[model samples]
Target chain A: MNTLRRSVSLIALVAVAACSKKQPPAPAPAPAPAPAPRVNQDSIDRANAAKAAAAAEAERQRLAAATAAEASRLDAARTAARAKLGMVIYFDYDKDEIREDQRVTLDAKVPILNANPDVKMRIAGHTDDRGSDEYNLALGQRRAAAVRRYMAARGVADGRFEVVSFGEQRPASPGESEDAWAKNRRAEFEITGGGTALKVP
Target chain B: MIKSARLLCVCCVCGLLSGLTPAQTRAQDTAVASGVRIGLTYDRHGKPGIAITPVSGPNADSVRAILIRDFDFSDRITVIAPDSGEPPTGALNYPLYAKLLATTVVQAVVTPAGALHVAVHDVAQKRVALVLDIALPTPAYSGDWRAVVHAAADSIEWIVTGQKGIAGTRVMYARNSGRSTQLWTVDSDGANARPVAGTENAMSPDWHPSGKKIVYDLLPDDGRHRIVVRDLTGATPTWSTGAASLNFSPVFTPDGSKVVFAAGNDATDLYEASPGSADPPRRLTSRKGSSNSSPTFSPDGRRIAFTSGLLGHPEVYITDADGSSSELLTASGFGDRLFRSNPAWSPDNRLVAFQSRINDVFQVMTISVRDNSTRQWTSDGANEDPSWAPDGRHLVFVSTRTGTKELWVLDLDTSRARQLTHGGRVQNPAWSPRLELSRQP
Candidate 1:
């Protein structure tokens, strides 16, 4: 009986020891800075690279803005030059000949010719849709010629100006009213050659 | 004496050669120049009274005079003076008569209806080769006389060229007015223009094989676009497409039985509609995420070439009429940087002509189907929207190089282009098919 009690006591002691759940000893503390060295270097390099990219992007945007500003300025200058060189001479209805009222416009256009002596211009004369195309074209030419003659009288060389007839080919605005016809019957100046290049070829 | 007489004979022969009468040779030249012979209308006195009134007014006299003086001008009939009760005797005698002096007689008259009537008579045939009438409102001043006379001359041009005159035809174009883009049609000479439809953002315009119907895209109040066919023959159009969605670039099959137009929102594809029916459109292209538009039918209706925006940007594509076996025709990768659009099939169906933006100017260019070679036809202006003349030897396009867009005709063979419309900005020309039956030869 004594032997049996001793063996059971020993088995119980072994089970208690297994159930105690003793933990393994913690690993020796690592050397102070080894764990995170590569991560820190990686983060620092990434931060530096991002800062450089941001600076480059900002610089690019500044350059783009400058380019855009320059383009806008050039466009404005061209528009101004075009306005100065252009002339719209009005005519009477069904007739492409210059009317007395249009002489004032012609007088104003003389300064442009004096300023741009070498500028070759095309005077496209137009008419309302009141007649056949061929008739309108011939009428338009006469109107352009009338402008040309006036320009010549104003001291512009004849060779600097060419005449084209758009007779009923384009309209300022579309309508059958007298207002439209009056607008359509006019000569417009187009700068064909020798003007400062507004946009490059 | 014999040697002197021989020398005199030689001198006489040389003198005869030198003294060939200038007036007599001029008469012979005139006879040769006027290439027609005419039988005159017999009168009671046997004198043909052909009266020519002065239609030349304003600046036309100078232009007409220039044309006549510079160009070869001939007459088929010689006018003789009238007898005493009328001015001269022997005016009716044929002994003094000569052969015809002109090929065609150009008659100019201001008709009773206030229209200018110009008739070209082939004197030998004694029949009118061409007659052109131009309607001009009575002038505020004396008369629109110069325009009328010039118009008459232009009408006679049809007789000389053997092509239908552009005087009576119309031009269709797109314009922006008061913040709205609309499709409009005007007289070929740029008169009587009004909005057909699409008062807001209209794009391509396809005329039915029948000149009566014009189909174009009309933007809806909701912002989506739909194709609408308007019959311009009536004062008000009859809308054929009852439903509205994102429909665009509609073209009729060669037979005009069905229309193939682009439909849908993101997945745009071609659809054909049967006449007078609201049947659901059958989808043609099957590729998902692919958008196809601007479908133009071949002359035989066997194939259609369209622009596809499937892979990034737009490219020209051709497919069978039933929408199968698709292939890409234009490869833009190699130095060809032009932006090509508006493919118009040639009248012969062997070539496709299109407008391309090159060096900031749009010009008409054509590609041959057999060799896939392309050639540019125009370079003078901001030319675009080329429509082939029915004869296939000419193309009419729009140009803005004059600082305004206008219709211009380019002769294919001559490589010469002339402006057609002057005062109005015209574009999107769809040339009519040759009339099935022209006025008999």
Candidate 2:
């Protein structure tokens, strides 16, 4: 008995909610006003036209609200996606090839970037303090380009991406240790365009 | 062209170079009377001993000390101190200096008339070989008087050897100030270091052909590196590479006409641009799947030497100024790691110096531009960023020999190196061309 009552009440509440969305509150038509005696043809037509216009206006409002809600939702998704897209990928010493261990990092960015076609990006490459600063810059660019190519292959527009190299100029860590060096040889991502609204992958 | 015949104690050479020589060899440095045989060094017999006599005045003691250090840096002359009272002003006791094995003596005085009175005495000839009255930069000890003393020492070197000393020139290097790497200038002797204005995030600095100007890679906010030049006389003009490109390692031609640099879209390639111009840069070198950078020009400006990773690792390469007739300069893939970069062509056009990876560490190496013969220079600690002094016999490079990144000047002739900076991670030293200031007061 309790289950049947709960179902009935739930259905009624849904019906009311749908009504409020479709049209603003108004008294139900009074039994067609007892078939108004000798109503003029022009008056009848005008009344129908006003009712139809009201329905159209209510439909437009519902759609505008739905669109706004959808846009904000996409904006939030893109914000989260941009953060994921910024995740860095590492490379081996003196090597620009994407390492096996770094695939997951790049994989995460690929889907985010693909889903946000309007978003442009700058992929910067960096190196440790071991090699020449100038050549390390080239090496850094190679690493950044490697990341860019990987994304392009995965459907991120190639022209939407730019690569810059910091060489050994910008070290993520300072020292000569293997750990410091490993942390420094990386390609990092930054979003350059496409504001809030983003489609989630 | 001065030929100074000095005998190196066979016993000393035996201990240092594993070769014995008697004092009789007179290991002569008979420099052809053309100019300075700037390539001479102490690794051989060295030069005749010299003495610094007493100078009278308030700053005399400090002046003498500075001059001693300057001459020592030559690596061509051995300095000595006089035992007794100053040589009688009338006649320098040539016998006293000769007996002390100091065949040469130097005398100077901070005269009351406000000049550094310098006299280089040749004990062998029983006469003074050189004399100069240098104008004093007043307030001596508190001012830039050190340069005045260095100039006097250089004059003595000129009289003793054909090569004038580099003491008066300045070095432009970048010092990492924890927050940013800023450009700085110091004497080649490592004194009077000061940061340059507007050089906050700069690196790989090179001097314009005229010592009055400098060019360096400036790191801006958008992550793109820009090529910028500043004049010591107060003009800062930028050589725009592009708004969306990576511009690395910009250096000026010896003639200061075009700025040679490395910039690229997909792969880094060498390029040349006009200073202070916004026009597109002319591409110099390109490869299908490789990166080229660190473009340095030979002294004559006829050839360009740079580093490329076309062979799967960075190696030195040489090409004509127009990027034709390219040939590999240094080929090495030690431990399967092809790490070689920072190619610096020698001022004499005889060698191209670069850093090579060996045993998992970086060391300075120079390859013969004429022949493919290579020589490893610094083996102590990780040494990189080699820049040749105007003399070509001296190279200023960054080294971790002291357990930190410090500036070091290596005298190729003597095979001896000295630290120029202490305490900070200094880098990218560019030895200025011999300027007129070194010859002035």
Candidate 3:
């Protein structure tokens, strides 16, 4: 048992010594020169510099894209607001009251008015030439007022809408038949805010 | 009678100016006043040179009284009862009697036939600074003596003023009765309305630039619309072209060489055709996948505006007559809430008025061409088919807010609107250009 133990210890010492040997003996050939430490340091420095440049380029591209997107967003909003400026609400022939079916249109207008707090509209009422001039004029006034009232109730400020009575003077359709008279009676809205955005439907 | 009429004609012309210096106005008013004296006398025929008595016939006094009353209202003339005489029996030497009247205060003589031979006297020019010979229309004393006198007085006013008198002018328009429309001609102030075309779907009338012809679209029983032009002086109407799919809303070019209209092939498009030919219509607008209709020309003929549906919705678009460089003028879904059509340009090309659909209702809207400011010219009723008056101050259109569609007029400056037609539904109005009369020189 003591001889075996001594032999194992000897093998371990031999393995460690063999692995630790740095240079191979070749009949005492010229020993190899040591490499310069600064060469490795220079390589490491170039790698770090390239990485920093890449990160800067990426940041510039991201900023340019953001600016372009912001401009596009502003243009779209402006177009939508201008389009909604002259939206009009129509009515039945000789009738000044708003119909139930027209609620959807009125609802659509609410957003436009709300978004554009400074926008003002002129609500004009028109009638066909079926009645006396004085009567049609009065009816036209009522129709315009009805639209103004509805808009005011729907969160649009009362001061935003002005009423004008064209009476029977201006007919969308100049005729003496039911078809034309039906087309003639109605109310229209003109935007008084943000310049003239009069759109014809 | 012939001699008496000539004397009345001269007096009518001179009498209109005589009242300018009413003894009261001349003495008291703070403006320039001038007066003309008119004398009535009968010419003597086949006599021993004896002056004919002016009050010979029973109708003579009545006619003279009518003339006197009319002359009193004139701005420049006054009726003065001078030496009166019996009416002559037969043919009188008119030139000789007119010469004799020159020696007295008389300026001219009137014949019973209602012809006025105004004397070109040398002394009158030196005296009143007015010397001109005017032949006036003979007034018929039998039916309405007042009418005759008024007619003579109007003639006098015309001689004094270089402006053509409105006494003989006529106004033409379209009238809607029940479901059909008819062409109508009337006096300026809604008097003597007579249907030129018996119950026909006559829409969009235009006066020939010459004012002698009217072009309109007529719909026959076949439901096809055709363009027809009628001679206002006579009865017969001649169709310039055969039936088309829908040849409605016709208007004459400013020069009267061509007619621009909207016709339906699958959709309505603008077309131009010559006045007296069957040439195939020259299409002005292409089928841009939308219904393009209601073409109107500007006064200068450089620009045109029509309703087009190119942007997925019907809207008013302005372009050159040849359809180049077209631009959308109105916003989509406007007047389209119900239905919108008919675009008319003001005479000055400064404004364009159109029908728009709002909330399922049609209304009238106008856009100023200068700054593109849009305003609702009408509200309340189903107003459509707007045509501008020649003066550009008033507009005529169709409306139906009062239970029936009728013709209406709106004065732009005053914003005053009035109903023109009482009954039936009227649509598609085109104001005629000014009319010119061929004077019997």
Candidate 4:
């Protein structure tokens, strides 16, 4: 009986050793859960920091592009204003009618005048030095009236425009050539009021 | 009328002198306060020859030169130089003057006290026609000497032709002096030229019938063209078309009571305004869509001649004083239908002179009111803005014949044109009436 009891005790000790090795697998699951929570928290903090930095960088780039676009738009508006102000409409000899080619120049003025409602403009008619001064004065007045009528038809108010006739007294180019006379027979526009707001390029 | 009276007085003087002895006649001529009178008749067959002896004293050469030039410019007389051996000073040499085929002889001498003595001899009448003595303020005043000579020449012209010469008168014109165009007045002989208007853009000056006022278009610095009636007696603006757009081509009525001008912004029309009226001007024309301008009244102030574009182009039109019964004076057959402007009525009440465009060039033309017959006086270079002299036998106009616009005077009888102003484009000549009131010694 004593020898049988001693052999059982040795078997029990072997089982105990095998159980201890199995116990390690169960604790490993518990510690694995704690370490997993810690690793997940650390990873979450790094991901959140990276996401905020990326969003800030994208916002900065967007603001830079928008500012560049606005500057370009203002520059273009100023250039167009300058061109519109300098535009002149030519007329035929001894005629006050507006030609088809001159419509384009007149059309460009409509938008500018409409955009600035408070602006007052002067439409001056000029003629070449060919006819009598008194007669030329009448012709120039007709030309200026024609221009005013055209602009009025295109929604420009009459109150904003003042028509004047320079007749043969003022010549754009002082000469007797056809080219110079053609230049002299023209309608010129001047912004008499509300011109301070126009940005110069 | 003054000439006929002077002629009668001269005949009486001749009758009285013929009854006296030669020595007694000389003593009576020196004692008579009236000038010596001799019956002088002009040769009708051709231009009469007048001999002028060489003058002596201070500024005598200049005076003689001026007299010769003025006589030549008269276009009514021919000057005959004395023979090489002829005496510079002498008594009546009627036979010798007749031998030279001269109807009249002029002798001038200056005394040591700076007094000018002029004598006119009638070759046919065999006597001195007239004698004039002028005292000079200073012997060194050459201008005064010229003036005295001009006055004598005028007197001689009146005695010969029954019409006063324009040598003592002045012509006002618009002179473009580089920076600005101003109104200037020059002696009829183109001497003593000076600006009458201030330094501003002025044009189309017209003289008052009284010769004491001027009406012109003044372009002020404010850019508004105004018709200003300026008084020469005071050198102040009597009236102005304030803020009127396109007011121009103003002329005083023949009676000098009203001013007719072209005024409008869209359709120009003639309007009459008083010199000092505060009321708005009276519209003289009612034509719509047609421009009427350059108004001039008849000598009687019963009719007005103006330029109108009613027929698609400018043409001269005449209307009653109230702008009624309009008649087209210029026909298509007279000139191109492009332009006719600057109408000036003659004092004789027979002709209306204007500038008409012919073949793209402007020329001076006249249309008789009775016959409607048109006659062109200028064909070379653009001639325009005709103004009749007081005598109605001559006209002052602007011409571009010398490649620059200048003032010129045309004699109707001789059809001769003489340049009056040189340099710097000039235009719009206005001949004044007899300026006896304004003549300065």
lDDT of 3 at B69: 32
Least accurate 10 contiguous residues by lDDT in model 4 chain B: B12-21
Output the TM-score of candidate 4.
0.78
Per-residue C-alpha lDDT of model 4 across residues A1-201, encoded as one tens digit per residue: 675566557667756765766344544343324334555676788798888888888888888778878877877886687469658899998888997899999888888777778778777788987787667777887787788889899998877877777777778887778999999998888888887676543
lDDT for position B150 in model 2: 66
Where is model 2 chain B poorest over a 10-residue stretch in terms of lDDT? Answer: B9-18
* CAPRI band for model 3: incorrect
Q: Write the per-residue lDDT of candidate 2 for residues B175-254, one digit (tens) a residue.
A: 87543688887667665566676788888899887676778888765677887777764535544456437887889999
* Displacement of the residue B441 alpha carbon in candidate 1, Å: 28
Evaluation by lDDT, superior candidate among 3 and 4: 4
Model 4 bad stretches (over 4 Å): A1-83, A198-201, B1-45, B83-87, B111-115, B135-148, B177-179, B197-199, B233-235, B335-337, B437-441
TM-scores of chain A across the candidates, in order, are 0.56, 0.61, 0.58, 0.63
lDDT for each candidate structure: 0.55, 0.74, 0.56, 0.73
| Weakest 10 consecutive residues of candidate 3 chain A by summed lDDT | A31-40
Q: Tell me the deviation in Å of residue B30 in model 2.
A: 34
Best by DockQ: 2
Residue-wise lDDT of candidate 1 within B265-367, one digit each (tens)? 3345777886556786777776565556667777888998776656543456788988899887665532354346567777778778776667745667888
lDDT of 3 by residue, A16-97 (tens): 8668978877485453331223444555777877777777778777777887786566656666655555555567764667
RMSD of each: 30.4, 14.2, 26.2, 14.7
Q: What is the interface RMSD of each candidate, in Å?
A: 17.8, 1.7, 14.8, 2.3
